[model samples]
Target: MFWALFLLPAWAVAGSACLRLCLAAVRAAATAPEAAGDDRALTLYEAAFLSGGPRRVADLTLVSMARQRRLLLAHTGWATVVDPRGRDEMERSVIGAIGPGGQSRIAPVRAAAAGTEAVRGLADRLVGAGLAVQDGAGSIAAGVRRVRLAALAVCALAALALALPVPSDLPDRLVALWFALPLALTLGSLLIARMEVHPYSRWASPAGQRLLTALTRRPGAPADDPAQLTAVALLGVHAVGEPDLRAAFAHRERYLEEPAAPGH
Candidate 1:
């Protein structure tokens, strides 16, 4: 029973590799644009995009409401903040998830302001970072496959050792602890390998959520997410023809077009 524990570190290493691979698989497999599900990072982009508005009384009121929710979520500090030290630190810090299950949003002053270049820059950076993460997921998936094969070999060796006839004088406690720990850790690692966060689901909600909408949309998917294509389509439009990310600066056009009132 304890044979698995001695290999705990190796199992954890293998597990993290598999976790990365599984997440990569999800990123690769998720092709349905409309079917994208909710995620903390995607919600951040959405919140930032919506903050740029007509600045009407009603919009301000909505912002106030969102703020109250933010306050409540902050009270517990249970939100999902991505790697603060990552290359995309600006986007991650400016916008993040809050509340239980991290259902709400927080915005950076730059993204929230009207007629600012910062909003567009943020969107471009977010899209770029998101694409990188998705690609990394793919790489990790390949790495996991290799690690699993190696793990099987290790397991076999450990099993053989376990089966070998031993002198009766060996301490039972030592035998149990050595193998049991690694196996338990390995099993736990396997469980963590299955986390799924649907990035495309960012578009499903529309309450001040343009960033989420734009980032998650995969508008041109063929039958069955063919060819594993990836595109960043923030807002209701895809950035495909935007030309060198200059389109990010153009988000002000949409901000200027907002209705005089929120929800109008």
Candidate 2:
């Protein structure tokens, strides 16, 4: 039937996306490194990097600055540098992003912070130390997105099939049932992926997440140290006890909604 022509491409694309995502998830899980022993404890910055990738590292840096009274984040999303001198490269990069005027938007500051050599240094260390996966966290996240897109494609295909006129010999109900097959496949793949990937869904690898879990389980861990607290903030802003600091990093939705700043 002529409808077959339209349905074929949709089926192919949805099927392929589903298959690729499923395989990638399985391969990642099967090949992931086992957790390291507690002796190989992660540094605060390293924990930030592992738990939330470069942006989290940038967030940790920003929180650290605020805690040190070197920077201020306003509720309206402006960042002000109270002190210009940066004790380290990461701080320096944030200061540079604030420009010479000692003022800039928080979004731009985050962008610059993530691109700094300091962030890259942390990433290199994590990868080299084998706490982070070699393929990178982005790849895993991308796979999840691909599966989601495939599910949408399947839904579109089902709608199309329902809208098109079918042959007199073919039952309309049968066409709906037929299209449901690929729809089910795509949805099922997505469900499986979410379940399998959720455990290590953040920036951390299986090993890194395991270490993070253990680290958090300790009594008063990361509580006495500012740097350690910043790392915990990276995991989630809610973990930061300070109300202002928590609000400062609560821009996660903003960061996700907006495109990355240019040249970042």
Candidate 3:
């Protein structure tokens, strides 16, 4: 009878977590358009967003600008506006995020640039074209968080079960062994999610992922293009090949200079 007290909640928590996690996973993958839209090929920026979202787009732009000497990225992790001109909306965003002082730490600049309307605008285009994940990113994140919370809840129930009186004739290990069923469920669910849910992630839908793979494999697609689209799109800044470029991004310091004085 006492076993009923804890086992009931344990099973409930475990079942709930798995259910929520599993609910839309298949739907999420299957719902996206499987074929390309309008025969449109993914642009470098679009590829970046599809592979790694807005941040990857920002990284791609930063790397592009740095290569052109329009923006100077130092090994010490600072971004200095060199051209004060943008060739596109994304370039303008990076410049604007740096502010009029023309200098700021790379981290904040990256965050601000990534959050800019220019980036979201790109997302809008991708989603409209059926290349980006249609599922709200917040939902995906919340689902993952709920699964984690459920794991903890299951553990709590197990503890409660152990604390309560054990049914006669059943050994303590036997009770734990029985409770292991739910514990195994939570762990197995987590492992399965890590593998199955990662490929599509939050940025690219199944169709978008297919496009990314196509871009990388297309004929005459150089391994190290001027944009480094494949590397940055797939791996973000970590794939940055330039030592100083990577160092500039890795800068974790919080630094934002004041706006330039009114007069020289």
Candidate 4:
């Protein structure tokens, strides 16, 4: 009984979080509008921004620079500039982020590029064009995070309920019922969220996703071009059929394990 008393607050908090997430999911779905005709023809960078947010744009820019031979990304995660000139604002921003040395760690370059006017411009353009869901995207992401936390809280509550002693007056079944309520609520909320949010990508709304799908289906598409390569980075390797370009976009981790000595 004392354990149940201790778990009551957790149960309440989890239940509330679950309810809020469900409401948020429903509201996002209900308020989302259909895309306009012109909005369907999204540029590679624009699609990247819509599908993966500002970070995707930065990734595309880096990949584009590498493809153009203006930058080199070593497996060690260092980025070096081959050409100091930047033809466009996005390219210029990336080169500028590398600083006067013309070389820096990829992670810091990404961080700096993420704050550039070019990235901000891309986001603003997407939102203004109605291809991105503005405040709703952040809200949905937050709600999903809360739902995940609620799942953890439910597990904690269950463990607490089981570990604590029960009163003589209360049956084991009653104790189980109490714990089951919050668990069910949490699970149900997750289910609703999955169904409602599954159609939309991380940043792109349903309409943008639909357009992305159509654009990726065309045959004999060129993946070597900077624009096409940018699309490949956004849509992932599956969308790029060319082996060479696919290899170019293949992500390498920053750290690598050194080989052991021959004697060892």
Relative to the true structure, candidate 1 has a C-alpha RMSD (angstroms) of 17.6
The global C-alpha lDDT for each of the candidates, from Candidate 1 onward, is 0.36, 0.68, 0.75, 0.67
TM-scores for all predictions: 0.27, 0.77, 0.77, 0.77
* Winning candidate number (lDDT): 3
Question: Which residue pairs come into collision in candidate 2?
Answer: none
Candidate 2, TM-score vs. the true structure? 0.77
Which has the better lDDT: candidate 2, or candidate 4? 2
lDDT of 2 by residue, 64-174 (tens): 788788888765466788999998887898898889978766776887888888888877766655566555534465566776787687668767766866663567677
TM-score, ranked from best to worst: 4, 2, 3, 1
Scored against the true structure, residue 88 in model 3 reaches a CA lDDT of 88
lDDT of 4 by residue, 56-157 (tens): 777778877776778887644567899999988888998999999887766667778878999888777766655565654455666777877877877787
Instruction: Mark the regions of model 2 whose C-alpha exceeds 4 Å error after superposition.
Output: 26-39, 133-138, 166-169, 200-202, 227-232, 246-264
Residue lDDT tens for model 1, 138-241:
43335445446545645664565557665534465565455555455445444454343322232122211333454446355424223221232222223233
Runs of candidate 4 exceeding 4 Å displacement: 30-39, 135-142, 166-168, 220-227, 235-264
lDDT of 1: 0.36
Candidate 4 local lDDT, residue 173 = 71
Residue 130 accuracy (lDDT) in model 2: 50
